[model samples]
Target: MDSKIVLITGGSSGIGKAIGIYLTKKGFTVYGTTRNLKKYPDFTEFQLLEMDVREPQSVNRAIDVLLEKENRLDVLVNNAGVGITGPLEETPNKEILNAFDINFIGPLNVIKSVLPQMRRQGSGLIINITSIAGYMGLPYRGIYSATKGALELITESLRMEIKDFGITCTCLAPGDFATNIAAGRYHAPVNNDSPYKESYGKTLNTIDQDVDKGGDPEEVAKKVLQIINTKNPKVHYKVGALLQKFSIVLKKVLPDTWYEQLLLNHSKK
Candidate 1:
């Protein structure tokens, strides 16, 4: 194909939107997935298609729409996910399930749906958006970290499984970034009776502060472009400030107690 086709989930805004625009400018036909078509108007640069990653049928339908026109998929980016903050005890089971549905299972659905086409094409790229939190637990956001960690593990095994078919699976672990996800994050209600009320509020405040001062989304888009251009991309790509990126390294080099203390100190507002 003259134009390589790219499908990126959660493309309504944030990093996903930026990535779609960047790839489109690079001469690739980009298809972006959004749950709500009304929210995102027509983009001169790329096409926005309706997709709910949480539903297998919806994911398949969205990919089918692209396959019908593009004929082949060169890249599939699983960037659609949700965030949550709450003490495990205080957080409802429903909220936790919803988070996993969107963050973990949602990507799984897309990956499984797109594999058949990619296999037939004989080559493709699957990029899963993970987080530094995946490397270590983020207290109030423990479930979110678990979801990312799970995705990271899956991508690793998936790469090993699909390498023979000329398909590549990579995980992109990013730190805080300037995005609209903060305002929409799921936060459990903390009342006076809750034991973790004060701590949860403090930890969440610290996390929010980092997000407020996070890196630009354009940087992330640039990194995605770099990955796409590489002939052989690594299984894991980390993008963010040195301070945050280094934390993953530090986690490996430091003792367990030291690492825990570091996280505790950093998360305390």
Candidate 2:
């Protein structure tokens, strides 16, 4: 069998880079997308294409290039996203829209661009890279959570919609993974006079610390491979520390108020 061709958006760094490297090593032909192709003159783990997920034209062009070269696309990893942190009330409308555009709408653009070819091939796998924070509303990171959560639900709908076309869609929600996401993350300034200053400041610090101490992104890459190899993949999969994965379970069984309190307690820590 010919090697599977995999395209990973946002593949220049972080979890995306890890996945591309792992897949390449496993004998899959990989293409990773970055907005600016010139930034990484030395990216050799896989082929890199220029694509900004937020733009449909750019997405289509990149896919066209890949399809022209490979003639078939077997896998698409919707991994391009941005992180946003701020008190909901304090975050600017533009910033909120920008976050949604990059995190939610961006993936949609890429998915739409690739679907026609995938349908033509009658078999394709799309793995959406979501977040554990998306499972619940984090205090300061509500917008980011909302974006991932939306993608999670969208993936569910997409899976059902495209199943007839022999297309599979699933979401992988990663908990704090040590990555450069923080550096590119949008943070509404914590103002001296703002009402949410204290609590928001603390929560922001905690968020960063978690990322700083987060797990290796290669774990997520491994899980992606596992899902790809599975005969029938589940709609949702999570990769993170034991406690982080357990939080989803806790959300299932605990009382609403109790779970809320648990989150409050954790945030206050």
Candidate 3:
């Protein structure tokens, strides 16, 4: 069998970087893409490509170059994303659009760019790195959650649509992982003595505390490897600490009033 070729977006850092390293060690040819390649440099086991997923032209051109060089693509991992933190009302419209572009539309661009090749091959995998926030809403992160929700829906529809083409679409919804996501560039609406300022302050503090308790990104990358190697991959893969599991289960089983209260209590802290 030929070595599996994998393309990972946002592979310069975080879970994407870990996944690239893990897959390379497993003898797969990994191609990692990012806007900035200097940070990652060149690696013997993997090739780094520059791509801006938000731009359709950039996405298409990158995919073209990958295909021209490798002649085939076996797996694509859409992991590039940005987080916007603030109350819904306090988030500017452009910031919300940027979040959607990076988190949702970006993946769509990559997927569309790669689908024809995967279909021609008659077998391939596309893994979308969603978040626990994709499944459940969090305080002061409505915009981010909305983007994930959009991805969740896209993954579901793609899974159903591409099965006949021997393509698999899996959604990897992880809980809080120890990553630079929070520290990454963020744009919050100017607070002009907003009424929600107090609530937003408390919510931000809670986010900081939770991130301190988040899981390791490398561990999450291991899970991605397992999913790729599995004979029958599931559509949804959830990973996190016990609290994350509980939160997901509670959101599903608890009454609306109860869940709302739970969210309120957490936000206040």
Best by lDDT: 2
| Model 2, span 1-269: residue lDDT tens | 79999999999999999999999999999999999999999989999999999889999999999999999999999999998999899899999999999899999999999999999999999999999988998788889999999999999999999999999999999998999999999999999999998888888888889999999999999999999999889999999999999999999999999999999888867
* Local accuracy of candidate 3 as per-residue lDDT tens digits, 40-122: 65554478888999998999999999999988999999999997898777677888899999999999999999999999999
Instruction: Report the backbone clash tally of model 1.
Output: 0
- Candidate 3 weakest ten by summed lDDT: 36-45
- Candidate no. 2 TM-score: 0.99
The numbered model that scores best in TM-score is: 2
- Candidate 2: the clashing residue pairs are none
RMSD of each: 1.1, 0.7, 1.7
**Comparing 1 and 3 by lDDT, which wins?**
1
Clashes of 3: 0
lDDT string, candidate 1, 1-269, tens digits = 39888899998788898888888888888898999888767655689999999999998888888888878999999999898989999889999999999999999999999999999989999999988889888788899999999999999999999999999999899889999888778988777888897887789889888988988888888999899889999989999999899999998899999999899888895
Q: Which is superior by lDDT, 2 or 3? A: 2
Off by over 4 Å in 3: 38-45, 185-192
TM-score of each: 0.97, 0.99, 0.94
Q: TM-score ranking from best to worst?
A: 2, 1, 3
